[model samples]
Target chain A: MDNSVLLKVNQLKKTFIKKSGTVFNRKKTEVYAVNNVNFEIKKGEILGIIGESGCGKTTTARMVMRLMEESSGEILFEGNNLCTIKNAETNRLRKNMQMIFQDPYDTLNPGMRIVDILMEPLNAHEKNLPSNEKLKRVIEAIESIELKPAEDYLYRYPHQLSGGQRQRIAIARAVILKPSFIAADEPTSMLDVSVRAGILNLLLDLRKKMGLTMLFITHDLSTASYMCDRIAVMYQGRIVEIGPTKKIIQSPSHPYTIALVSVVKDLNYFIENREKLILDGEVDSTRKDTGCTFVTRCPHQEKVCHSKAPEIEALGNGHAVACHCHSNWLEKTS
Target chain B: MSTVLSIENLSTFFKTDKGIVRAVEDVTFSLEEGEMLGLIGESGCGKTTVAQSILRLIEYPGKVVSGKVILNGKDLLKATDDELYSLRWKEISVIPQSAMNALNPVYTVGDQIIEAILLHEKVSKSEAVKRTKTLLELVGIDGERQKSFPHEFSGGMKQRVAIAMALACNPKLVISDESTTGLDVLTQAQVIALIKNLQKKMNLSVILISHDLPMVTAICEKIAIMYAGKLVEWATTEEILNNPKHPYSKALLNATPNLSDPDREVVSIPGSVPNLVNIPKCCRFHTRCPYAFDRCLNESPELREVTPGHYTACFLEGDKNG
Candidate 1:
């Protein structure tokens, strides 16, 4: 309902049915990849979704992008529920929303030139534009990504470019449509460490220059904290915590979020000297219908956490946490 | 203060049709007993090549042309093939990068570890199996799952198994080449913790080769920054992270995304790493370095000790410290 909200996801759910048993007797098991997720991205804001692999962060982003059909829920994009849109309408809506995938190597067509990659989005979305206008737009897009001497890169193939250059091309393709909202899923994870900062800075710069709203999904908390204004911590198909980046890092409310933050290797020596709270045990993705996904590894889990799921409780400053022992944790820490 | 491994002016080159690819050039560093040294560099910077050369894993046209790899007291290069084979896994072993794929998928996790132990030591099959279970438990994997295939376990679990296999022969030195590259943050932290714990418990010396600076800082006591096969800088992790002196080292630290300092500006080092075959005659980094001057173009800087503990190869330090 807020005017500032650019995109709102309401109770989104997705499930995959897998066939089991022999050919004679078929049985099915539902894999709930994402379930009952809710969040919102403000206009021109970078909302980060942080989670481990198979935690439904990618699934959530895909569902919002409408790349995959959701089982149930509303994906409201600028007052329009994207889920209600028809096939023809969805094509038009895609112009305003785009996604940049994790692997740059797989995302771009190997045989295609950098110009063609950027032009594909424009040709599909802006079919009405003239040939000369399209060429101009393509050049503009290349320059927008700060790939100077755009002419040199325009005709070059993906292989001719470096990892950082290819990613910049991918970004150029995503923004060539002039999308108001974009979902970038681990864009810099595949890049070398020396080139990662350039990509991150380019994204931040592009966000301001284009006035774009972004949903940045990454498993690295440090990267999320650096780029995002707000973050939602997801675990096993559910969002366990949602708050401002500073709050999530400094005063994480959810036990899982706290564990995630604590595990990040800090660059500062003083912080490195402090004791680390090691979260023993691995993340079990196959566990079925558990009360709380994090209860298995939670340090302060109570008996109630094993049987009853905790509701998201308001923790002030637009922050929320879902944990049964949050109050007890607060008291103990204070 | 005893040195566990000392590499002196080590240079490894790969002969290709195009030219001689200088993979590791004049790289020198020493690792103390029970110390964890982090070798941080980009993909083509020859960090892994240095690690491989230590274990004599470089095959075919690639050769370690010069320098001595002195482990404990013996020169590893001069040791006989039979002696080298015996010394490997017994005294020094490696946990390679992408250990998940490095593991034998056909063999069960338990069998592979047991095979490693049996090959190194004149132990019975049953005794080797027992040691495998203990090693698995040590790395925090379920000993019962040893019967399962590599595919049956997750990525993190597979890496743990690899670590177990590396430690099967009770080797004193473990060279881990990008051990935690593909793992998620939590798993990476867990693996690093496991390595640190094991290092302290066994008094093991580790050569952790990775491009991930943060991960390196977490586990390593000393850090080495390499660029185009050259040792650009070497110092304590604290010194390297907090007071990087070399231009390449400073640029690398600046490029890393620091979450704690969100307001700081991010500046990337321009241009890619030099082509190995046509590497610059002087400073390889002179092409991309912002501080490069005419003097840097004519002569290569030697790896000099700028301070008591820290060493950097940069002509600019001479003006400031002189």
Candidate 2:
């Protein structure tokens, strides 16, 4: 147990039972949404989990937040296995862990006022606080999110506020508890680009001010490059590559990571060479159990990739890639 | 290069109960033949309304109050409903914003495109189907699966289908409004590349309306930044990226996450978009402008040429090159 580590996720796995076909011809299959995932976050670090849609990034985030139970794994928080904890203990532990969802409109209650929304966590966790003190805490939370003259927005409903404002209120609600760890799942995906920067800046500011460790999940590589200290690229319920953000962006080792980095719309680069480094086919999440999960669409897949899954091989300085053909592909490209 | 479309002082407003919402105000720009222009703006910034105004797509309470939308030497605004109807698919077509809900799920993808072809061109059913297959192939979709319903296809495939449908009648100009809004990175890249390749092969004029700045700048030769129903800046892609004169354009480019400038901190413009119904008499962005002075608060700036092939609407740049 590393004392500096805030949260450790070891061999996290989740299986979903998906049913299809009519009642007369029913069929069921097991889908591994998060399979054998492992990662660690130190205090005050921002670890980004990025992937295409249905690539298990959100699933991994959910399992870490304990919003969804893992099928079998260990989520060690501060040297305690969260899964083995009792219900009452887990509720207390949740005070240090918070999550912000993708859609701010859906996450915040439309009927409640912004003040009430921000105060729910305080009321639940700090029940013994006096009314005046609670209201003071509420105002502090609202002010922390930079909604000027906190009184102006305290009584307004979610519908009355814009998308960015609602997201701020949601962040206020999450950080109202002063959580040490936060899992933000596509927090800015629904926002307009201009408004999205505000939320990202707010998150970064709060992380600096409060010493919060963030698991920022997004589908945009450019954003991940901007906000993350390190990035873990997920594909079909598995992290194919994990490394420092610059390393992943500059020298992506995995085939999927390379494809993702190449697809980023860079104006200067695209004009000089309009050639697309594209990979065909959508991500197939139904794992066959024996082969590499990315083999279905991997551009550099070979005979070895079809029979055995490649283990994560370290390449020094906290960069690792899980692919058998990485060395061969690197040799060819270089 | 000859001009394919010219818009002069285009102003579209909605007479809502709250008041008259000036959605698109005094907007003017021109598109060259076989050129690609990107109209980039935030939501409610009136980029979509401008596109609607060009095609007379606004209805009832919302109307294009005054403008000259000249298409192939004819002012589209002056044309009758019948004339506009005929001109829509024949001269200009649109790939609408959302691929998820824009498509009709009941109709087969092939039939919809074929219907589009049959409506405009004097072609037989078999001939329309043949052309539809070619359009499908042009967008990189397999022509055989054109018979599948919209629900059966993935998000990217549906977007390709939309592109195919937009090109059914070989319209000289295509207006793709946020076509890649909700797609994944790879899908968005594929769609953008497809549009670029199609533009080259067909020599078609394109007006790409989107909030994705990087995607727009990557493909479009010219970029227009819209804020609160006004064209704040317009320039060649290179000039716009390198030397953005308008404060709003500069802030937008700064706010955007660029791969090349990885270490830059994205500074968000303070304040939300102003209410369109009661836009201030002065500059619309004056409230959020960090460098705003008393003059900016009292007067609005006009879009003036700052350099060759670059224009900006800002008081800070002064009248040096105007």
Candidate 3:
């Protein structure tokens, strides 16, 4: 109920049923894609969700954007529940929440010109505006993304642009409506390293210019640390750790978070002597275990980690972790 | 150390309708025994093209124009079809970029690796099957899971499987062309560590082609930086990291965000890569080079050694070295 909060997701859960076996004999099972996830984004803050593939980061973002319906929990956007909003109300809120997807190749329509793509969002949201006024706003959006002289790019198709340019057009489409909250799912992962910095700097510039709030989702810890004000590390559909970006990178508490932090390759001399705590196997989302989700791959897993589920324990200053052996590990280390 | 592969004045050109695209031009480097080299560049900078040209895998429109690719004292460029075929898996193999679809879906992972071993070596089916098991285990995959199809393994595991297949024939040189591109960061580190340990243990020379600066510097002993179909700098990891000669190399290091030093600015190099079709005989990176002079605009600089083991192809090197 904080006034400064822009988007709040409370105990969000999404599950899918998987069926197998022969045609005559069918078996069903539940797969928890996003289970009991909680996070909050302030008016102009960026919260990043970091996790490996199939760890429900995308699912959580989709449910928050109302692109995917959640099986349980509430997604409150400025104190309004997006899950239960009526069509008219949802249509109105649509202009305020936009999503930038991962792939630039698939997101934009190759056949359509850049002008039409930028105008689609405005046409849906501001139907009563004059054609000239809409065209002016579209040109402004194109320029805002730093694709200047918008006329040069307005008529060109998506295929005509480079990967970086195409992504700029995609970003232009997202910001054309001047959305306050944007959920960018791996926006720069598809981009090359040299071009990636430009996109990241552009987003940061847009945030300063428009005071935009972002839910940046990426599997790269360095990018998450750079862009996010706060970070949430998810595993097996649950957030294992969440804290301020500095705290998460410097003093991560959870075992899974520690393993993830240790594996991040930086430019500082190859972490050769760094802890080699390599987690085995990928996230198995199909497991219906009642214990901690990361128990299978955790290096410091104890008996308690298998018998009981770990709850989020606050260590201080908005820093929290869900791990059974954290206290003992801290004591042993200290 | 003995040299495993030496590429001398290698140039590969693609004949496009617009004009002849000089993808790789007069690139020269050598890989020593048990050494790992990282070829770093932007997307269209001919990093992959260099690998393809070395392996003699350049397709129809693309041809290796000139130079000698000497592998273990044998010239791959002058080799016949039969000689190249025998040299491919026995001496050189590639871990392709897309591990997800690099494999055949119908064949089991074990059978595919076994097929690779059986085709080049004169081994029986049973021996090949046994070798496949050990190869799978070498990359950290369970030997039993090799029976599963490509779809059954995860992305990282599939990449590991590809690595096992690459080493199936005991190739002397392995080209990992963006092998860890699509995997997660944690998984990428794991796969990279696997490759590193294997290279050291087996004494295998590797050519890692990637755009990831941090990773390329972290593992690879030597670094070769490419900029638009031309190598701008080649040096040891320490030399490249401590004192980069080329402006393109410095710009690349600046562009990559350092996780350890989060406060450093990540500036992107301005201007896109120039179109390669019928490119002028000047420096390809002159358009984006901050200190590009009139000479750089008119004439291309050759890769000349400034220090003992460091090579750079920038006109500014003359002013700075002296």
Candidate 4:
């Protein structure tokens, strides 16, 4: 295992047996929510997994966090295969891995006081910490998130706080364990735009202070660009493109990646080409795809693209794309 | 340049247990024939309330306390229930925020649109059905799927069906309040493109209300920025995007992460929007403004013209020197 790599996911796949039609006529069909996904996060680097809804970004994060069982493939954390780990060991390992969910309103228990919520993790891990020590740690965590004065918010329930404040408390809870890795799944998507920046900035500040590695998942391209050091663009459960943030934004290779980037509502470019929609067609995950997953929507697709899946081809400077027509596109555009 | 809709001194209030919540206060703007105006704001900044107030959709405990909503030379605020009912689908219509609940799940999409057409027009059922098919096709939905229930259609398709229903009567103006809020990026693009094309073909005036800044800037000809229930800035889309005048507008533009400039530091406005039950006596945004001084906290600023076709309500704009 490379010490620089904090976590690595290899060929991770997950499928669900969805049933349709009523009663006796029900039909069971397999939908691969996540298939053959691969990525890695370096120590203290933020790796963003971005795609449209149901594109497997969330499933990938859940699988890595051991929240959902992966059907096959390897999730290596600190050189350990987390998939085959026993329950007792997994629970112990969870102290270093935490997840922040999208909706703060639903993530935290509404009935519990903020202090108790923060204390639960500490008690579970430490087992015999004194009450005053726990209280000091909770206060320290709340103050770190800037939920000012600590005492005022310590006794309040989640409902008593606004959406922004609730999200701040959520962040505070996630970091209370001093986790080495955090999976923030659209932490700011449910927030108001004005307050969204504040949360994002807080996350960045926490990253610097704690030296944490993150797997930030989101559907919004602009937000992904802002929060991520590198981004992996997923389509139909597979990573179609992965690259540095600047390269992904400036010179996206895959047609699916291009479509995702173009759809970004940039005030400058959108004003210039408002009428041009790069791609269409919704993602149909139930389809048993043999060829490239993005063939149906790829504008530059060829005969080979419909017959066989393309391997991820590398293009220097830490950029890679899984598209057969990448070279052809390069020739045409350049 | 005929004005299709004009709102003057609109102040809407909600009688909550906490106190009288001024959801919208002294909001004013206008839309010309065949123009698209975007109302952009945060969640509780009263963008939706302004749209609801235009059609008098406020229910008990909520009232348009004072204002004039003039639509096509007539004041809609003063129009009676019967007159407003007849005027609704025929002259103005709305595509509500959530397409899933905006449409009745039990009724076929075709039947719903046809029913709306029949209620506002003197057309036979057959004629209404025919118009319904045309309207469905206009929004890119197949006429063959007209019999499908809302559940059968995808979220984007349901939104398109909602659009078809809104345009069934060829209303002169359409108000779409967060119409594409929950749709995915591709679906959002397709729906917005469909609306833009339809608006051009029919020469329909549109008011699009959303908190998504990029989506709003992409399509709207003129843009209005609302903060704490007040229209803080109004300008042509280019002017506002390029040279925003008000401090709140400037913060909003900066807060949005630009695809072109990913490395730029995004500084969020410090405090959340103030509760309207006990709004401050001065500028509503003064609590969060970085440049706010004693004057901003003591005296309220009115909307004043800062440049050609640009208006801002900030004491900083009035001060030539810091």
TM-score, every prediction: 0.96, 0.96, 0.96, 0.96
Where is model 4 more than 4 Å wrong at Cα? Answer: A265-279, B319-322
Candidate 1 docking category? medium
Please tell me which predicted candidate would have the highest lDDT against the true structure: 3
CA lDDT, candidate 4, residue A100? 92
Q: Write the per-residue lDDT of candidate 3 for residues B163-267, one digit (tens) a residue.
A: 999999999999999999878777788788888889999999999998888888888999999989999899999999999999999988898887787777789
Candidate 1 structure quality by residue, lDDT tens digits, B1-322: 7999999999999999998999989898999999999998998889989988988888979999999999999999888899999999999998879988998889999988888888889999988888888999998887888899999887888889999999999999999989988887777777777788899999999999998887787668999999989999999989988899999999988887776786677688889988899566688889889999998998888888889889888999856787
A133 in model 1: Cα distance from truth in Å?
1.7
lDDT of 3 by residue, A43-152 (tens): 99999999988899999999888888999999999899998888799879989999999999999998899988988998899999999999999999988988888899
How well does candidate 4 score on lDDT at residue A24?
86
Model 3 chain B: worst 10 consecutive residues (lDDT sum): B256-265
Give the better candidate number (3 or 4) by lDDT: 3
Candidate lDDT scores, in order, read: 0.87, 0.88, 0.89, 0.89
In Å, residue A36's CA in model 1 sits off its true spot by 0.7
Instruction: Decide which is better by DockQ, 1 or 2.
Output: 2
| Superposed model 1: Cα runs more than 4 Å off | A19-27, A265-279, B318-322
DockQ for every prediction shown: 0.58, 0.59, 0.58, 0.58
Which pairs, if any, clash in model 1?
none
lDDT of 4: 0.89
TM (chain A) per model: 0.94, 0.96, 0.96, 0.95
